[model samples]
Target: MDDRLSGYPDPDFSLGTLARMGSSRLVTKAHSLLVTDARVWPAPDERLGDTVSILIVDGVIEQIGAGLQAPDDVPRLSAEGRVVTAGFWNCHVHFTGREWSSAATAPAESLQHALDDMLLSHGFTTVLDLSSNPRTTFALMRRIATGELRGPEILTAATGLTPWRGMPFYVKADVPWVLRWLMPAPATSIGARLTVAAQIRGGAKLTKLFTGSYVRPDQVKPMRLPVARAAVAAAHRRGSRVFAHPSNRPGTEVAVEAGVDALAHVPDETEGTETLLRQAAERGIRLVPTLHMFASTVTTDDGYLAPIRAALGGFIRAGGRVLFGTDVGYMADRETRGEYEAMRASGMSTADILRSLTTEPAEFLGRADTGSVAVGNRGDLTVLQTRDDPSPADLANIQATIRAGRAIFLRDSPSKHTADAP
Candidate 1:
C-alpha cells in the first residue's frame, strides 16, 4: 500500500478515508442579501427589461421587480448593468479525477480553484454528473447542500451500466484498473435491474446506461434490449430518470425501445438519421447535444461535422427538447464557446440555447422552482458582464455565479469587493 493509503484508519477503505481527511473545510452559509440594478431574464421565455431588483431570503427568491428597495438590515449587491439569468445547468458532466474524488480532503483554496475552473466559472449552478464514483460524488453534494463547499447543485447518476463485455475500448485503454469499479457491467437482465436498484438506493437521483459503446474505432457494441429495458424499468420504478449513451443506430434503437428519458449524445448522422431523431423526439426522448464532444474527441472532417449539425437541427425542428452539456470532464475542453458556435451553426436560436441551459434541464429534473428568476424560486443565478440581449457567445463572459443567494464564483475586479454589497 502507498504510504498515504497506510495512514487511513481503515487501510481497506477508499472514499471514507479521503472524506475523513478533508472534512474540516465544510462551512455552511450564515447570511442573506439582496441584488439590485441588473438586467434580469425572469425565465427562458421572459426577460425583464433592464434594471431589476431581486430579494433573496434564506436561499430563495423572496421578491423580484423594478425599483424594489432593500431592507435596512440585509446586505445588497449592485449588478451595475450586468445581465442576470436563471442559473445555468450543464445536464451532462463527469466528476472524474483525483481533484474531484478527494476534493473534500483538499485545501480550501485548491478545491475552490478546481471547482471554479471546472464548473462554477462557466456559470453552471446546477450540473448532472452522468458518471462518477457514487460515494465521492454524494459526499461532495452533501457538503454543497450544507454550504460546506461553494459549488453547484450536483445530481449524480452514480456508476453507469454497460454490458458485461461492453466497456468502450477508448475508456478501457485509458482508465486505471482500480477506477474501473465505477463502471459496472451487468450481463443479465436481472443483474441490470439489481444494479439500477442498488444505485438508486445509494443516493443516485438518475441512472446512466451505455446503450451503445465503441469496442474499437470502427466497431460499436450495444447493450441487449432486455438488459436496457430492465434497467430503465427499475429506475423509473424508483422514481429516477435514465440517460443513455447511444453510440450509433443500434444503440439508439435499444434506448428508444427502453424508453430512456434522455440521450447522452447526438448519434452519428447516418442513413435515416433524421427519421430516427424525429421518432426519438416524438417519444419524448430529450437530447443533450454534447456537440463539442464529437468535435474535440474524434478526428473528423467537414462531412462528419455537417451530418451531426443536420441531425441536431432536424431534432430541434421536430420539437425535440435539447439540454446543454459539454462533456467537460471527459472531453477536457471546459470553455463553452465552441459548443455555442456549433449550436448556432446548427440554426439553434439564442433563446433555444438559453432554454437548454436553464428551463429545460430544471423542468426535466423536477426543479420548477429553479431555472427561472421568479419569486419563490431558488435564488440561483448566473450574472454575465455583457451587453443587453447577449448572444450565446457572450455566455463566456460570466461575471459571477450565485447559488441559493450566495455568490460562489465572482470574477476578480478592482471594485467588486463584497459579493452582496450594493
Candidate 2:
C-alpha cells in the first residue's frame, strides 16, 4: 500500500517508521541496504576485520569488504564503526497479550509500536512463540509475511497441551473458570496425539507441552508419561520440534522420558534437577534458561536464585545447548539486560551468550542460512553501539535491528546519522 493510500503523510515512511515495501509482497523487496565503516563479528567464534562494509541486495548479503561500491540509488547506513553481527533470535516468546488480540486487523501504526517496544527494539530479528492463540498468531504471521507490518519472523506453537485436570493457577486466575475449563489437557495418548496433529495442521510449525504445570505455586501436576510421549511422537512425525514446560522435577522427568526437543524453563524447582538436567543434556536435549523470569516473577532471594542459576551453569557444563529467551509476553517486564546479567552470573561468557542468541538458535531450528554474517546468508543483522572493536557484555545496547536488509527498528533517527546520500 502507498503512503497516500495508507493515510500516512510521512514522506520518509519507508526509511523511517514503516519498513520499505519490496517489489514482491512476500519478499521485503531488498530493503536494499549498505552499511559502511563497521567492525564485524560474523559469528560468536568467528571475528572479521574492522571497518568493513557490507553490501546487501534483494535481502541477501552480496559482499563484505573494507571497501565496497554500490549504486548511488541504494540506501547506505553509516555504522560509525559500531559492532555488527548476525541478527539475534529469541527462541521463546508468546503473542497472547490482549493488544495482540487485534493483531489481524489492528492499525499498522498501533501494532508496530507494540512490536517495537516488546521485541524488535531489543534486537530480535526472529522469535519462536511457544504458545498462543492460533487465530491471533496466524493473522499476525500473514500480515508480516505480506509486508503489511514490520516485525520479526514468527514461529508459533499455537495452543499447548497440558496434563489432565492441569492448568496453571496463574493462567486460571486470568479468566472465568468456565472458559478456563475449556483449555486442553489430554488424559490419554490418543487425545494428546489428536491435539498435536490438529495444531500442526492448523499451521503451528512448533509444538509446546506443559509437561508440568503449577496447580499451585508450591504444588504441581505432571503430564502422563504416555500422553507426553504421544504428543512428542505426533509432533516429530510431522517434523515439528516440541518445547516443554517442566515446572519441576516430575515435569522434567516427563519431558526427558517423552523425548521433547527442549525444556522451556529451568524447572523452577531445584531438588533432583541437576542430575536429571545433566541427563537431559546427555540426550541432546536443549534448554532455554529463562532465569530472569524466575528472578523477576518468583523470588530474588539467594535461596531461590542461587539454585536456579547453578542449574543453568551445570547444564552448560554438561554440554546442554542454551538458547536465549525471556518469556517476555508471559512476564510483564520485557527488558533483556537482566537476563544477560543473570546468565553471566551463571558463568556464561560474552561469546557463550552471543552464541545462545544467534548461532545456537539457527542450528536448533535447522536453519543453515541464518545466525551468521556471511556473504550468502540472509541479510539479517543487528548493529550494536560499541566503544571498542566488537566487545559488548550487555547486548541490550542495540543501535538498529535489521531483517532481510530492512531496518525494522532503528534506535536513532536515520537523518541525524552520517551516511552517503542515496
Candidate 3:
C-alpha cells in the first residue's frame, strides 16, 4: 500500500520534498484578494448579483460589487461564472482517533491531505465537534488559529456526558480505548453539574449530553431527569449551549424538559413524534438532521429510511431550525452528497438547505460576522462550479474553499488560476 495514501509518513520523505510540492503553501497567508465574475449570493435568501466582484483585505471583505478594482500587489481569482456563497458550517462532527488528535504534530503532507479530504474539500470553514478529547482538539484548534495547521475554525464540546452504564453498546464494543476515555458517565445530578463545570473550565465552548443512550439494539436508557436538568442548568450558567443526543422518544422528552438548546439528531420516529417535534420547535430547540448517518448505519431500504425521513419532514414542516452535519470524523464517510440527497428527499428546499449550511448555523453560533458575503464580514467563501440556479446537489461542485481571504483548498484544473489580471 502507498504510505501517503495510507496516511503514514514515508521514511524517505524530507522537508525539501514538502517545500518542493508546495505543501507549505497549502495554508495561504492572509492578504488582499480580488474575486471577479462571480455569481454572488450574499446570504442564503439574498442574491447580490449575477456577476459581481469582491475585494478582500486583511482577511475581511473590504468591498463587494461589480467591476471592483484593487492594488497591483493584490492577487485576483476569477470565479469563471461560478457561484460564490458564504462558507459552510458543519455543526455535527468529531475529531476522534490518533490521526485527528495528533494533527498539530503530524507531518505537513499528511495533515494537509487529511484537512482537505475530511473538511475543507467539502466547503466547511467552521465545524463543531460534538464529542472529542478537549485537550487534543483544542490544541489542533490553536494550531489552526495560529496558521500552523490548515483547517477549519473548530468548536469542541470536549468530552461528552452520559448517564452511568449509559455507554452505547456499539461504542463499548467497537470504539477504541482512547476515544472511550473522552466520554465520561456522571451517575448523579451533582456529578452531571460538576462535569459540566469542569468541561467548560477546561475550554469547552459547548456541551453535549447523551440524554438517550443505546445500550442495545432493542434497549435505550434515558438519562435521569434531574441529572439532565442539572447538566443543562450548569452549562447555561456558563453561557455554553447544550446539545442532546436523543436516541429515542423518551430521550427526546428528557432533553426537551431539561431545556437543551439543540437535539443532535431527529429522534426515532415513534407515535407522537410529530407532536414532540412541534414542541421542540415551539421551545426554540434546533435540530441537526444527521439523516445520512442513520442511512449509513442501517440497510438502505424504504422500511428503514421511511420513518427517519418522515420524522425529518415533520420537523421541517413544524418550522424547526435544521443544521447540516454529516458526523464526518466518527462515521468515516466525509462525502456530503448523500446527506444532501437525504435532506432533499425530506422535502427541504434549496434555500432551506443552504440556510442550514450557512446563515442558520452562523446565527446559532452567535457569529454575526460570518455566513454572509458582505462588506466587513470575514472573507470565508465557498466557490462552486455550477450553472445559474443550482440545485442542492450542485453544492458538491466545489471549485475552491476560502477562509479569512486565504485559499485553503483549490481544485486542480488547467484553466484555474489563483491570481488573474482584471
lDDT of 3 by residue, 102-183 (tens): 5545676766787889899889988998876554565566667667666787777876787787887866664544445445
Q: Candidate 3 — what's its lDDT? A: 0.78
The C-alpha stretches of model 3 lying farther than 4 A from their native spots are 1-30, 174-182, 413-422
Kindly list the per-residue Cα lDDT of model 1 for residues 1-422, writing each as its tens digit. Answer: 23222111122434434344233343345346678888887777886467878889878888888877766877677788799999999999986655664544656676667788989999999899897655556567766756657788787787688877888886676555565555678889899998888777666788999998887878879999999999999999999999999878888888988899999999863555567788999988999999888988884577788888888988988989999999887888889888998999999877889999999998898888998888889889999888489887988779888888888888885435566442
Show the lowest summed lDDT stretch of 10 residues, model 1.
2-11
Backbone collision tally, model 2: 1
| Residue pairs of candidate 2 with colliding backbone atoms | 22-29
Residue 221, model 1: lDDT of: 90
Clashing pairs in 1: 22-105, 27-147, 27-148, 76-420, 76-422
Taking all chains together, each candidate's TM-score versus the true structure is 0.90, 0.90, 0.88
RMSD list, candidates in order:
4.0, 7.3, 6.6
User: Which is the winner by lDDT between candidate 1 and candidate 2?
Assistant: 2
